[model samples]
Target: MNAVVFGAVLCAGVAAWVLCARDEAVRRARTLLVGPWGPPGPGCGVPGLRRLDVRVQALLEPFRVRFGWRLGRELLCLPAGLVLSVAAHSAVPAVLAAGAVPLVGRWLRGRESRALAEERALAAGALCSAVAGDLRAGLAPQGALAGALLREGWPGRPALADAALPLLAAARFGGDVPAALRTAARLDGAQGLAGVAACWQVAVDGGAGLADGLDRIAAALRSERDQREDLRTQLAAPRSTVLMLALLPLFGLVLGAGLGADPVGTLLRTPFGLGCLAAGGLLEWAGLAWTARIVRTAEAS
Candidate 1:
């Protein structure tokens, strides 16, 4: 009776570690990647990647909803691949494929983000050129702003179409240019833009030198852009190291499996192996969560 009771307790513990406990760990790790709790369901939106997000989110729904958290698209695929691997009675391909999804997503997102960023940069550059030309022609800040709005054909014209143009019109009809730029800043989502608009607003409102203020604001933007670039360069190496570190143990397991080692069979069949697999999966998720937190901190800074 004693031995039977011990064996039952051990089996319960193993089951908890593999299915129930690991799912919880995966969910917690996901919450770290996305903002708190996510969209409250399986299908969530990832801006600019809706279709892919929905598919991945659907696949991840079971793990997430059951565990009360969200998971990264990449991590969501991992368990599915793992389950498939076990179902197909193969472990090596499962782990490798699971790990590759996130890396591929990251690469694709990075490329797209870079292209969008370049568009924004070109828009800013055109806006600066207009400001410079207007300044050279002795236009007051209000006059220059109006000219830029009326000029048309500038990159990101819509950025100013609604708020800036209407504000400039009001200024021309005897309203405040500073107020208009401030309104523009408020409407658009970029702080640098708001800051530039505010600088112009202050210049016009306080009767400061319009050209000098524009130059100063542009200088500040240039400094900020430089700092962001430097930070990205600094972060690249450390982020790669973290990813490589995370994959090391999983790859080692895969290597064992490829060598015809029965780690999966043992993991599924034996109480000790199951507990270890469960513990390892939890630890892997915890490590990824920790790494993600570090990245978030860096990004916020």
Candidate 2:
């Protein structure tokens, strides 16, 4: 009976999650296509879903600063963990799982930020190269920068666009282009823009060769990008090792089940099993955290 109920609840939860996720995606897609904040589409326009989204968003508002706009999605783990605890007939694991969700979300957000920085870094290099070409073709510095940014041949245009907005505005309005570049440089992966700003400042102040300086900066960024790619390849081994180790607990459960043992019932109903589960989970979390820190340290260096 418990198994049947758990199965039904899980099915319902999965269905709801899928439908909600699809609606959100569709709404976002439509909004993008319309080139503005268009009306919500289909399921998203339903009051129940709309209110559910708003209420969930409100609940997660306090966490918005740390997690950005994705806190609501992370909070879904709470109900998921609850459903799992129901199946396991355990509240302790559920509580721990809920608590870990935010930390896990934070870790994921950091990884995403790092990846975005890499994209922006590559985009910055492309922008600099294009700007140099435009300048050599006799375009004004502002025109060169604008044309380079507006081009659609690059992979990281969205990231580049976000980082270059201030620079673009300054160029268009004649509002201290070097200062704008410096502001854009504050974004992750946009450190190259600082060099570009320095070159611009020199050109503006002393008539130094801006094109030549930009070319050098672009070359340096490309070299750094290539080195990062090589380093990532080297780092993949440790990442894969950590992932496999993390899955060992699940593998153990599968093996136990294959041996005709009631592992789930044993873990959920017995005190000794619960204690072991708690200890093992804590150690697993610690191991992952420690390995992640080491990888981040290596990446930073």
Superposed by TM-score, candidate 2 places the C-alpha of residue 56 at a distance from the truth, in angstroms, of: 7.7
Query: Which segments of candidate 1 are over 4 A away from where they belong?
Result: 1-129, 138-143, 146-177, 183-189, 268-271, 299-301
Question: Superposing all C-alpha atoms, what RMSD in Å does each candidate have to the true structure?
Answer: 12.9, 6.4
Model 2: per-residue Cα lDDT over 34-68, one tens digit each: 34433333343457666676566556666655665
The best candidate in terms of TM-score = 2
TM-score of 2: 0.77
Q: What is candidate 1's TM-score against the reference?
A: 0.53
Q: TM-scores of the models, in the given order?
A: 0.53, 0.77
* Candidate 1 steric clashes: 1
Candidate 1, residue 40: lDDT: 27
lDDT of 1 by residue, 171-208 (tens): 46867655555565554233445656666666656876
- The lDDT per prediction is 0.55, 0.71
- Local lDDT at 45 for model 2: 43
Clashing pairs in 1: 30-71
Report the number of clashing residue pairs per model. 1, 0
